[model samples]
Target: MSGVTRDDRVHVLGIRHHGPGSARAVATALAELNPQIVLIEGPPELDAVAPLAAAQGMRPPVAGLVYAVDAPSTANFYPMAVFSPEWVALRWALDHGREVRFLDLPANVSLVLADEEESEAPMDPIRTLAEAAGFDDPERWWEDAVELRYHGLDIFHAVLDAMHTLREGHVPDLRTRRREAAMRRVLRAALRSEASTIAVVCGAWHAPVLVPSAFPTQAADSALLKNLRTTKVAATWVPWTSTRLARMSGYGAGIESPGWYHHLFTARDQVVGRWLVRVAHLLRREHLDVSSAAVIEAVRLAQALSVLRNRPHPGLPEVLESCQAVLCGGSDVPMRLVARKLLVGDILGGVPRETPMVPLARDLDATRKRLRLKQSAAQQDLDLDLRTQSHLDRSKLFHRLLLLEVPWAESAETSRTKGTFRESWTLEWKPELEVALIEASGFGTTIPSAATAVVAQRTAEADIAELSTLVETTLTADLPVALSGVLAALDERAARQHDITRLMAAVEPMARVRRYGNVRRADTELVQRVLTGIVTRITVGLPAACTAVDEEAGRELRELIDGVQRGIGLLDQRELRAVWLSALRSVADRLGVPGIIAGRAVRLLLDAGLLDVTDAGGRLSRQLSMASDATQAAGWLEGFLSGEAALLVHEPELLEIVDQWATGVDAELFDHLLPLLRRTFAEFTATERRDIGLRVKRIDRGAGASGIRSDDTTLDHERASLVVPGILELLR
Candidate 1:
């Protein structure tokens, strides 16, 4: 059977999605046929915004986004590159004053229907044809036969014929049947309209069934689509990227090499040569030493390989292979870069400012422009100094976006010593974030308002830990209105919460807000009062919480204790430090407390200068006594040496005590405790461990009798005097 059935008023041009050769052929045939109306394979709801495709600032490689109005997450993107046949058809019709409309299953119906049980996957017609043609790779076969070569409008007829044969004995699933029925309904409507001539641009697979003779009756088509569940949907234009167009990005109808297809569609002559020159330039930009001679060699090799493969011109594979051999010196490293920068490409499309958008998206666009922050598909690092107004505003925007789940910018690690004024972020904008912005619009119109609304809603069900984190997040985002709700929730949760661990988790984040709130010029008086109350409750409950804990629980409690200590340090409040230290002492003195907890308490006391070196050494000796249980002793050592292992290197008395206790343990006990000992010492730095070992050896040889040598303590006074005279001279 032939592909077209003697329809003089209408022409069905079947083309591949995003296929450049098909695009060229469609444009050529449209000029020749000059149809009065154009129908493309996309969601019909997008017809309202389809004219934006020809807008002045609307660049190619964008997508028409259709989503359920209530459930914005249930969405679909009909992406179009400059070379996509559908895009060409739409632009041509719009430019020439011809009517254009999308003729596929509306996303509103399709999104709801997608929840139904899916049928088994159908056979791949392209793969079947490729296998019949003795090609294993379907993409290569299609590119070689149709995309790389131009056969005018006859190619579409051939594609339609192949698809018809493929469908001869094959049965389509319910979804496909429904979709095809929907397309036929639109075609019937177009036929009944006043338009004298119509051109239908659709996927090659659907073309065979769209012919007038093959189309099912309108009543049958309507019956197939009757009572299908659907929702209210909205459509808009959004920027897209070539990287997202690649098959690797999970687009079902994606092409493998969008960059190569783009080259084929846009370049006027010497496509292979220009592609290689582009590759060479990319490699050179990466500091690879590619020269003109290498580019020439690569082009020659690609042409020769194409001739051997009997191709009309050099394809992507031939050019890539030539690049690997000649330009990259047979290394794949530089070639991988070439594949990313030149093969798949990092091209991000643009949409016109006048294009319709949700309020949230419009606000964000304006905000981005005002902040002088350009959206980019490529990853970029943004360093912000919170002291600067512009940087602070940018930081607030990023934090707000994160709250709304946009995550266009992710917080990266910055140096603590860089102080509270510095923040680092990694920013890379993806097209899908537009959908997120739209979804967030339901919360509020602007970024801050939306983020605050989300946080305030979450605060109702948030636990103490989440409330604490929310408090910090609100403070960081400078959301004063949201911060009030979070702080109230935190205070209420802390008051009723009896879980000491939960209370402890709240301390650090609240402390952080109090410590760093000034850097952002945020009000922290409320946070300070809530934190003080939480600390008081923690001090009351901590000693009892530390009692009767198992080894694992002890370790976890130890970490909480460490965090609390750090939080107290951040506060730097004299009265608060005293109360916290008193609580730690009580835990240390309490009988039946886990040795790990007691040991960490004592170590914290020593670090806080509440206990002297002699007291700490005596406590260590008692803990590691042979009379003590070996396992408990090991736990004590692990906890005591947890963070400050370098103390053993600096303090000879503690090191000597630990050394003697370890050597005095019985062999069986030693074997039992070896893993624990290894684990504890493993936490120590290599240099710390080495220094401790040397100190232990010196003690064994009687050189560290007083924890210091008398002669060394004499300090080489003559050498000190020599240094002092030089220091005085420099000062003078």
Candidate 2:
């Protein structure tokens, strides 16, 4: 039978699963009905695997998916977030003595439900007409009508009518309409036979069509359900968080506005306090001295924010701000990660509240523990004294390549030396892996992480040069950590051309990396540089490098470069000046051919004052030369030389190209002037360098203090940086 339910009058509840307002309404609606034959929208195959849900160790993110039996690879997962409405519906059925059934046509039928023919489909006539109606954004139109405002319970009835029109208007195909129509019949039958008010659950979009009169009714057929595929699937429970939800990841069913909605689900008065307690508890686990005072202050701040914002309940934002003020003391790094501990944690529960583990992972986990593996976060020095001979062999082999215990991994690694065997795993608990593990969960929990580990270890063993796909996938999956790990994994991968598409894909997470801020130090240099590099990479390669959906993204890349550059540029005056000077020089260098993209670079640099090299004032280089002394100044030479960044007068060709754009040089003459400026820097003198750096600094400070990072306390006021100008002068 087709895995999709094949039933008559099947009740389908269209819902935005996990949506608090929807869930609350659905629960209220369901409570009024006691359907004996409650059929929820899941793969019917899950009926065969219901035992897995109750299996002693099944976790979340596990799903009983349906695919073509002949083709196991083409499968669609029925994801189950903890807050999924389908999950709640099933639970209601289980508790109320109802015979719950998944009434979709069997997987085999639904998956391969072809009409035995193809048709040249007609386009929507209304869509053409809608152009005059200002229906430019279809999604926006839908959002306005249905995706917003959920204060009423009669919305279901309103939706029921809308589905009728939507099905005829949207799905013009007769064959597809019949499939949905048959399900409605199945829903009705389930409702009638059970003497129960049946509650049908489906996505909100589907509800408007499936009502009794919305579409044509069709009889369920065995032929309609046959010729599909099936797979033995399992289910599991996984913790979730709002931040990730905000990312709109996965199949788009993950709840949006989790922070906003969570208030409705959880107790209001205690949430902020609970969050603080959880944070303090997590900190305590990490051995941070989070005092009660911190928690109290955080609570007070949350209350203050709630009052100021006119919210009766203190929201996540308030709680977060409070936590940041009290615990972070300004830096939000630890607090964000800690919030994840409370929000989407590593703790996983089994489906059915008691599914058992998969075999391999279970066994491996048992072995690991028996071998006395510490489950706590890994540390710098770890000596796994393999007690058994085979264990010893595995350990030696692991060490031989994957471990690479040259010196650092030898239980004595430090920051100074690149350590071997000092494993750095950026851990994230994907509930899907637990589902993947549940199939193997019987074997033990180790199989999943172990299988992943084996794949990771193999890049080293098999070599990423040959296994380039693995390297790319790793990057696509989680870049900074994954790519960093792959670097070690390859130990010798060649400089494969940059796949900017793959790199840009990491922008979201990479952006998140800057949360590691030490605010007091005032040197946002690290994050600034990272953002600059990413923006630079994108801006330079865009407009053609990535094609497809990336066309839109390319425009965004230019926008993002400006945004990030602006953000970093807003640093306090001194730091901002230093950055501007350095960045402008970079623009000059990058403008040369075969260098990074520079159309945007030159404008940003010159406009930002990094290119003050054309002498806006008198000869500061000569002024500093005759008047400056090294005695009272700590590092005159260093300051002047460092200002080489500001002084980076480009060679002729690039400058001429810029002149063509900004200075309006005639094409032929512009081309001629390009080469001369290109060569100018190669022969520039010390006097020239000193004048540029001194001029930029002199303008900023009037010789107050030349500060670059020389020592932590001391700067290149006039020390080593002066040598660059001197060297350039000597060459001249």
Candidate 3:
């Protein structure tokens, strides 16, 4: 049987969801047909709110939000832009006083079905057909064939024919079949109730299936959707953004460029001129040298490109190419600015204040307004200097939100100029985070209180390492109310945990947070007290932990020792510093410790002034003595001097000792020791390695004084005298 059959009474108006062309065509068709009942393919749950679209200040780029009453997180969005065909059709019905209603399956079934994520099918039949027809991108083909070329009934007919051919080779899953059946049942009921014709606006792909003559039997359709488990759902309108209207936000039927389409729908008469003017405005604001002349040239070039490409109007590609050539000087930097600001306009739609939202989301929005941190869909970079109270407050709110897993703000890398004083964040608001906020509302009423409650709950079962991370998050979030509980938990965990490696690993982050506390003006007395105890335990147990470890275990222990050394270096109390240095001295002198650990121990002792230069030299000689094999001597050398190139670079005596050790080892032993030596030297910077090599060359050739050249002797006096005045003039 044929996939589609014609019916005169039902005017099936197929449309691209957010296409400007489709919106125009649908509007024209609705005006011409003048149907009494308009059945739109939208969630039926939002039918009551449909009239809200006609209300004053009810803007486009807003969405009808439907979520399960039992599980608000199980939600779906049906977003509409100013150029959307459904939006246009609904507006027409509202203006003409025609009855308008949503005819698709309700959100109760859709949200449940959405929860069962289907595995991606290996192939798409529509994509295959587009490819077979020699179009690499199916969307481009759809635009060129149906959207860009047709109007009124021609577009609907073209879409119907294309979808019919595609569907002939495609077999939809049961879920799709059920949805279509439900839609058909609704349309049949509408036809029966309304004597006048009913106009159906739906996705172009569903037009063929919705025809009354081709629809499945009413009895079978009812059985397919009968007795399905459903929960009550509530819906409200929420603001959306142009960026989220793009396909990247995972909207199934999203458009590529909402800004461009909006222009096509509203400003089609002078799209190129207005777009170039917008670009020129952005460039002038950025202080780039753009002018009226450049704008005029860009318009001309866009028209020329359009004519060359045989297009009726200048498309996005033409405008972009013209922009790159005329205004950007063939450089992509200015063009990128144009694309970001103009092509993807940062216009965020607004819903009526009376729209319903979960308490957490409502509270979050209020707090955001109070903090002057406006929510936007576009990603914006924010740099905060902790010295400022407002910036600090913004940072704290972001951290708290992160704790709740809202993920609206992400901490970026530290700023380059002001290291400790500044923090950076990339903030982008996603609509789905409303669900996360709803889930977290069970904790507390506000972001700060909720974050504190959450941290306290997690701290109950957290270990020392996890608690260490939690403490840093709490500090960054500025949650002083929860700090005491987390600190107490940390102290209790630290008292019970005897693993030296874990203790050492946890100390550095805690110490860093404590150090940052002074900058943030946050209370750090508990952190300081906890860190002191942690340091004392690490100092006492480190010597024992270093004993009898294998090479791999030695590497891990070495990292912990390094962390401890760095942590102790940042401590304020002199008594603690003395104890840490004493611990290092003991570890250095101990027998049977891994050579790498002993080397680190000796380096730390030397750095702390516990060992003089003479003592260091004598220790190096003994460690590299002929009594030990090349492997053992190499290991010892690697421990003390692996990452400390400055000492060797400046001190010839240490360099001479290393040279003697290298000469003393036999070729096979040297070959066996090459890897360890290479590993040790690899940590040094390139200049350090090169300088060391040059110093060694000087020592090997005994030419330190023989090759010295006087700078004055090489100068040409007459030439220098001639250029001195010119150099002075240039400098002045």
lDDT of 3 by residue, 332-396 (tens): 99887776777777777777666777777788988899889877878899988888988888888
Deviation (Å) of 69 in candidate 1? 1.2
lDDT, candidates in the order shown: 0.85, 0.45, 0.78
- lDDT ranking, high to low: 1, 3, 2
**Tens-digit lDDT string for candidate 1 (501-568):** 99898888888889988899988999999999999999999999999988889989999999899889
Q: What TM-score does prediction 3 earn?
A: 0.85
TM-score of model 2 (CA atoms): 0.45
Regarding lDDT, does 1 or 3 come out ahead? 1
Q: Estimate each model's TM-score.
A: 0.93, 0.45, 0.85
RMSD of each: 7.3, 17.9, 7.3
- Pick by lDDT: 2 or 3, better one: 3
lDDT (Cα) of model 2: 0.45
For model 2, how does the per-residue alpha-carbon lDDT over 323-374 read when each residue is reduced to its tens digit? Answer: 8788877777787676455554433333443333445435544655564543
Prediction-by-prediction clash tally: 0, 101, 0
Q: What C-alpha lDDT does candidate 3 achieve relative to the native structure?
A: 0.78
The lDDT of model 1 is: 0.85
